[model samples]
Structure formats: C-alpha cells, structure tokens
Target: GGKNLNDHALVEVLANEAKNGIEWLKTIDANLSQVGSFGGASVKRIHKPVNDEGKTVAVGSYLVPKLTKAAEDKGVQFVMETAATELVVTDGKVTGVKAGDTTYTGKAVILATGGFAANTEMVLKYKPSYEGFVCTNAPGMTGDGIVMATAIGADTVDMEQIQIHPTVSQETSALITEGLRGDGAILVNSEGKRFFDEVGTRDAVSAAEVAQPGGFAWLIVDNKMVEASSVIAGYIKQGLTVEGADVEALAAAMGVDGAALVETMDKWNACVEAGKDEEFGRTSFANKLDEGPYYAIKVAPGVHHTMGGLKINTNTEVLDASGNVIPGLYAAGEVTGGVHGANRLGGNAVADIIVFGRIAGQQAAAYAN
Candidate 1:
C-alpha cells in the first residue's frame, strides 16, 4: 500500500515517528478523529481532526492553534514579524539566528520556516519549467530559513522537486482539497468528458489536466457531496464554486458541452452504483453524483509543495555539503528533504511536519541541554 519512492530508512523513521506524533497530539488536546484514505493511499490511514462541533477542520488549521496555545502556555515566546536574515555559526556549530540588526543567541537553532513555493524567483531558479504556474502557498513561504542555513554551508536535497497540486482554483489561488474527489467528485475537460481517474496521484492528475486543451478542468460534485464535506461547503462560501441545478446546467455554466456532461454523469453514477470504474480503472468509489444542485469549480495545477530543502538526517539534524551534521542546527517540515523523495503522497506532508517537527524540537533541546 506504500510507495517505495523514498529511502527505506527515512520512510521507516517517518512511519515510526508518525505513531508517536499522533499520540503526542492527543496528549496536547488535538481533536483527531477518523482516519481517511487520501490520493495514492490504498488504505484509510490518514488521521483527520474535527472541531468541538464535530466538523472536519483542515489539519493545519486545527493543529496550529492547539500547538500555539500549548507552547504559549509553556512560556514559549513567539517572535512575530521578524524574518531570520542569517544563521550564526560559532566554531562550525549553529548558535543563533540574526533578524535584521537583532541576533537572538541560543545553544541550538531550529529552522522551521517553510518551503519556497511562493518565491517565484527561487522556484524558477530550481525548476524553470514552473514559470507562470500559480502557487497555492502563502506569501510568507519564501525559503528564508533555507537561505540562512545555506549561507552557513548547510547542504540541500531535492531542490528541484517541487510539487504542483491538481485541484487549485485559479481565481482565488485557493487549493481545493483532494477530499472532494475522494468523496465522489469527477473531473471533466472543456468537452465535458471524464479524461482521467479523479482519485489518481497529484502529479498524475496534474499532468492529465495540463494535457487537456485549455490546461484546466472542472471538478463537479453534487449537493450530497457538499453536505457530506465541510471543505467543499467552505469552498462554496469562498465563492470558488459555480453552481447549477443539474448536470446540463452545470456544464452550461462551465462552458462545456451539456449533452456530453449529461452522458458522463450518467456513466459515473452507473460506475458508482456498480462499485466499479470501467473506463479509468478506478477502484475507490463514494456516493453517486446524482443529487440535484451540482457545483463546478474551475481548477488547474498550482505549485503546492516543494519536496526539497536543507538536507537532514533521521534525527532532523541539518547536514553540510560533506554529508556531516551541522551541530546544534535542526530542520523539519517542508524545509527538509528526503522524507517524501520525489513525489509526496497526500496526507504525508501533515505527517511529515508533525512527526519530524517534534523530532527537531527534541533533538535541538537535547543538544542545547
């Protein structure tokens, strides 16, 4: 059920740490709930968190506040509006970080700043082919941590392996979650024909969409799916969805061939009812998209994740060009590479950040003590 894309040792470390991470979340009062299968996962192993009202909240949104509150309660001072300009190295060991004119000295430093997907120039420097691609990253994901670490002789890995998510709304640059397709949404081209399996991996689906005539597609879902997923409901509230009362109406609204869409919807509902996708060889099935009042979101590929950053070991210790650990320097999340290898599967990024973020904290603390 697992893709052997990454180093076996790294994957094993992630697998082991993921368990501890989930347990740690529970200890910190994270509201984790049922496990769901995401794209590229054969089993339902991705742990999702729900709010107190039992509404599914995006993992990052749910965890960030909880972790922040927990850390703040423990007297962790959060330095806001300060960007790290450099990493201070004392005798080949990282000792602190410099922000503007201020140097915050410490025994150990953790570079938790995110990836460079939002940095157009940095992204183009690594992968020139991604030019003109809309990024789904926040503006702050400018790889400042990576620049600081590299300036201090730290090495990076997989810098060119940036990931583009398939379902991103160009209008808002908002990432339409993969859960929509997993919950029974279908992607159709301008011709209103299903071109590929909607549940395929991000890279595969993105490529398929790029191959289409307009390099984009429409994700169609019925009211049933909207009711079943709060994520989709939120998308609608964000004005990212184009709604219609029926299949023909939705296709018309999407500027696709209405008759072709009707036929495609008929075939899709049949496949859902029969528990088989004969055309695309899709095995995963959810509720049929036959309910009235369908919604269509115009989506295309957008730069989502940079699968590379500062090279780090299993202990989250950042390494140098000679493959030696930079003592007292640690990194995690999208700032570190080798965890996801080339293509990161959905749900793994969350696991990566939580698992390795905890490890980096512990290792840095240990080094400091």
Candidate 2:
C-alpha cells in the first residue's frame, strides 16, 4: 500500500542471517554456487554447484544428507515417516510430540514442518478467493506444525497473508523463478503492455499481473537473457516456453498485440538508455531487452508462500496466546511466521531457515542441557 519498508527490522535480521548462513555453509563444506539474482531488491540464488541435466538441484541432494549424517553421528535418532499429530503438553510446558498413538518425549521441541501452501483445505479456509489457484509448494506442506503448535495455544499471526509469485508456468505451474526477471526479463500483459517495473518486488509485480486483462502476464526476454540464465533452460527443456524470431512473432504466438509489444520494448529500451525506470521506478536495469530470437512464457500469480504461522520472538522461542513464551517450545523456518510480514521478498527464505534454524537448535540444546 505504501513505499516504506514494511518489515524493516525483520528485513535487517534476514540480511544479517544471510551472512551467517554463508559462513555456516562454508563450515559444512556445502557445494553452493551463486546461480542468479532477482528483483530490484537484488537477492541472489545459492544452489549446488552442479549441472544436473539443467534441472534445479535441491539442497536435499547434498546439504540435507550431509547434515543428517552428521546428526546421526552425534546420536540423534530420526523417526521416519511419522506424522506428529499433536504437542504433548504438561503443566504449561511442551514435553514432546504425539504421533499416531505414541508420544516421543523430549526436553525441548522444535517445529520445522514448513508452511501450508500445498493444503487446499487450509488455503480455502484462510484465502477463499484462491480456491482454484495453483500452488507451488511441496505436496506435504500441509501446515502440520501450525496445527500441532496451535493445538497447545501457540499464537499465529498474519495467517491469511499468502505470497503469489509473478512467474509460474501456465502448464505445470512450475516456478519460472524470480531470477529470470532479476537477470533482465520483462513482463508484458495480453495487451503487450509493460504494466509495471519488471524488477519490482514480488507483491507489487503480482498485483499488477492479476489486475491485467487476463489474470496472467507473459515474461518476454531476448536470446541474450535466455542464454545468460539457467532458469530458462529448464523451462525450455520442459516445453513450457514459446519462441519467435522477433517481438512481433513472439506476441503473435502469445496472442498479444504485436504492435503494442514493439512499442513497449522501445519504451523499455529508452528507460534503460536513460539509466532510470521513469515508468515504474525500478532501480535495477541490468540488461537491455535488445536481442532477438525472442522468447516468452505465460505466467500468473501462483500461491507460493505463506507469511503466517506460529508466532515467535527474536530468540526463536514460540509464544503462547497470552504473549508469553511457550516453555520448552522452540520453532523456526517456515513453521513460524512474523519474520517477513505481509510479503516475503525473494531469496529471504533461505536466510531465514539457516539463521533462525541455527538459533532454534542452539536454544533447544541449551534448554535440554
């Protein structure tokens, strides 16, 4: 609604956590590489340093397994395939979790079960308007942590706020990645008009997209942007992209106005030439949309992130409904909310997970000791 930074303190925390995360990754010998950047906010991607047939290599491939082995070496036991159904609380303190008729007691408990974007019922319950909208979260992201924690009176905040990404595929709804726009792709509507700054924040860009003639937009890029970026390669390999010899052909293929597309490109180039985005005030003009063999992908606001869950304080301690810290209960990662406020900027999730997760682990360990 306004230009001021909404979650300024949280943003600072995330930024500092990013530095801590990089140091921790180095300590663990994580096979990380900077893949690309996104938004005028200039967030970068960190992924495994491998070319796995052009597919995105998730952290589970290397990072998670290593961490698991380390934890196992330290006598940490993992209960496989068990769903925690409730928190076992006694005398105002959380003792452990109840899973399918068995209660696993612990000195302290930490919930890292992620957000509820994949649960359609929860989506409908919180955001009824997105009943039929596509979600880009894992199938198991069903708000299990929120349910269990709240069962013990954990207070949840901003439970209704969800983030809609600007560039998810029309066919498979796979995320096209904000890194594409960060690397200099432009968003054009059905009228082939540049509706907003292509590199604007996620919420702003998504809001502009859903308000277009159709409830979607098209990300247009040149051969240079396509070749310089890895995200497009995956999309192209999956047959989710449309290509043309030029802007006219691209617009025709996308069913957009060809002349308008040309004019929009002209104006965008002029903005780049002027070293300023006069139209929408985007700060990053990394590349000019001036190369041909143009490419495009249809995109809409897909449900990507939830900004709400069990509320926690800066110590990563989960709080109760009465604003008191829940004794022996710690939460981190996507399971706890109030870090990103209304809209999470791109790439902040990784920092949030690493930083607060480390904090939560330390606090839990101290509590146990």
Candidate 3:
C-alpha cells in the first residue's frame, strides 16, 4: 500500500488483473441474491468506466449497479421488502424467515444484510469504543441480518475492527470516493503543503489522514486530475467541494490561511516534479498537481464500515455458540466475517459482496433443496 490510495485506488487494484491479488476469484462459481446498491436501489445504472483523462472519477461504490443487475438476472431473486424479523428454525435446522406479516420458507437461509454501524444502539451494545463520528454504511444498515441470525444462535467476530474512513467532507460528510487518491490526488492541510500522499489502500490512507495535525485535512484536486478521473466528477455531483480558481481562494473560502496553503503547494509541487513524496511516498506514475483551477474540500473523520459480524464457514453457513453448524443457515457479503481477517483492504468489500454473495446464494439455494 503506497501513499494516497483512495477508493478508486482500491477499485483499480481489484479490477486490474495484474494488481488484484485474487485474480482467480473472478472465475469462482456462485450466484447473487440482492445486488442493488443498499441505499439507492432504484436508479438504473450500468457498468461503464468513465475517465476524463488517465484520471477517473470517484465512481466506486460498495455495490456496482450493473453487476447488481447481473446478479439479479443470474439467480438472485431480490426480495427488497422489510428486513427479516425472525428466523424460523425447527430441530436445529433453519427453515425460513419472517419478512413482514407473511412467512417465507426456504431449505437454507443466507443472512448477508450488512453491519450495524448505522445502528447506534447495536454499536453501543456490541462495540462501545466507537463513540465519535457517524457510522459509514447506509442508515438502513442496522444489523438486522446479524441480530436475526444471533437470535437463532450465532457468534460474531472482530467486533472491534470497525473501518472508519477518518475523513469525510464538512458539509454533508460526503464520501469522496477512495478512487480519487489512487490516481495520485493529494491531501493538504489548511497550510497547503502535503499531509498524506493520497495514493495507497483506503485503510492505510485513512489512518494517515487521522494521525495528522488536527485530525482534519483537505482533499485537494486539480482541474486536470478532475477531468481525467471519475473520482472528481462523482464528488462534484455529490457537492463535496467548494471550488476555487487558485489555492489561496480555496483556502480563504474554507477559512484557512492563504499563504500557508501557497507554501504547502510550493513544497508539494516540488515533490510532484521530483517524483517522490518524502513524507508519504505517493507513487509518481501519473499526472502531478500542475493543473489550474485547483479545488479543495474540507474533510474530517467519519465511520465508513464495521468489520465485525456473524461468523460462518466457507460454505456460508452461520454457526451457533458451541461451534455447531446451524444447518439450513448461510451468510454472504458483509454479514459474514473471516474474509477480512482482522482488517479489510480498501476494495475487498466489493469483491466480498459479489464473491461471497454468490457463495451464500448458491449454498442457500442448494440447502433449500
């Protein structure tokens, strides 16, 4: 993980054949249940990579809409109703789930609803240390899957491994896609020089940003990089930035010292030219910050993900307290732990969704037999 790795960086690392560690994972046999983006499910989005130059926009989301559609078309019968309220089990084998008023029976049930970061009450109950910042997942993510499975007797893991983004925009807590820095975007303080390289894995970048001077920073993007990359366009559409014609103007608008920003930019510009970031080692393969109409967006810490949840085996079966398999039970996506040993890399979550989602779906369907 080099410096400045943002959401896009992680995505590229995964989709790029040479970089993706799990290249063989793309060939695995599996199916999907629910494939739409968790929060915004209705929008018709197709998968097409858009890059302004070699730089791209922050188009990375946990769930890719096109794949989501493909998963649905493949074998996943998306039941986008109310959350599952109860797991009907008899003789220690799960039978079905209670969605709302009606009961839906299945030979096997795969609980892949996601984590409880959005549920503060659940967080306090299981993980108390995360007292600051808003949880990263969509508000609807309330541990429904984990809780339902637990009621049927299942254990969770790495409850403490919550993946906090550590830097969100000041206005909407807007998520500037991790992809931005993957192409060499830089994060500067109010003073403008560099704080982090803005290039490696998401977790690593987040940790560095938080440890900086004020635990506050600015995600600086130049007009060139913005046009070349989807990361900037996505953020702009999301309105993460208060743009400026120059560095000073941006600093003034954000209430940071203009001269300090200028000086920071000077130092950073030198590093960009030299192809080395002494402080953070952001790779020098792409464009440097030499473009005009620079933009700076304010950012601070915010919870982005929770890494702890129901424990399951490779078969995607949720187990009970005594390490006994809860037959007819399965889990995929974020609901299941272990795929992310102790910490999840920047882009692994996406792979987790499709890859494990398929596993859970197939096993659940088979178990249903």
Q: Best by lDDT, which number?
A: 1
lDDT tens digits by residue: candidate 3, 1-369? 212222333234234432232333333321122111111112211122443344432334422565566567669777775767999997878888998897988677777788777888877765575576665567778878888888878987666666667457745756665545544566776555566656544566667667777777887778887776565776677767777788778777767788987877777778767877787665533466666788767777677776777877766678788878888888876776655644555555666665566667777877676
Compare the candidates by TM-score and give the number of the best one.
1
The 0-to-1 C-alpha lDDT of every candidate, in the order given, reads 0.87, 0.79, 0.64
Q: Tell me how candidate 3 scores on lDDT.
A: 0.64
| Candidate 2 lDDT over residue span 1-369, tens digit each | 213323455556666777777778776666456565565364445343334444334444456776777778789988888988999888988898999999999899999999999998998898898877898888889999999888778999878887778888757878877766766788888888988887777888888888999789898889887676565776778888898898889888988888999999998888888888877877666678888888888999889988888888877899888989999999887887788777786766777888888889999999889
TM-score of each: 0.96, 0.87, 0.79
List the candidate numbers ranked by lDDT, top first. 1, 2, 3
- Candidate order by TM-score, decreasing, is 1, 2, 3
Clash counts per candidate, in order, are 0, 0, 31
Candidate 1 residue runs with Cα over 4 Å from true position: 1-5
Candidate 3 has its poorest 10 consecutive residues by lDDT at 37-46
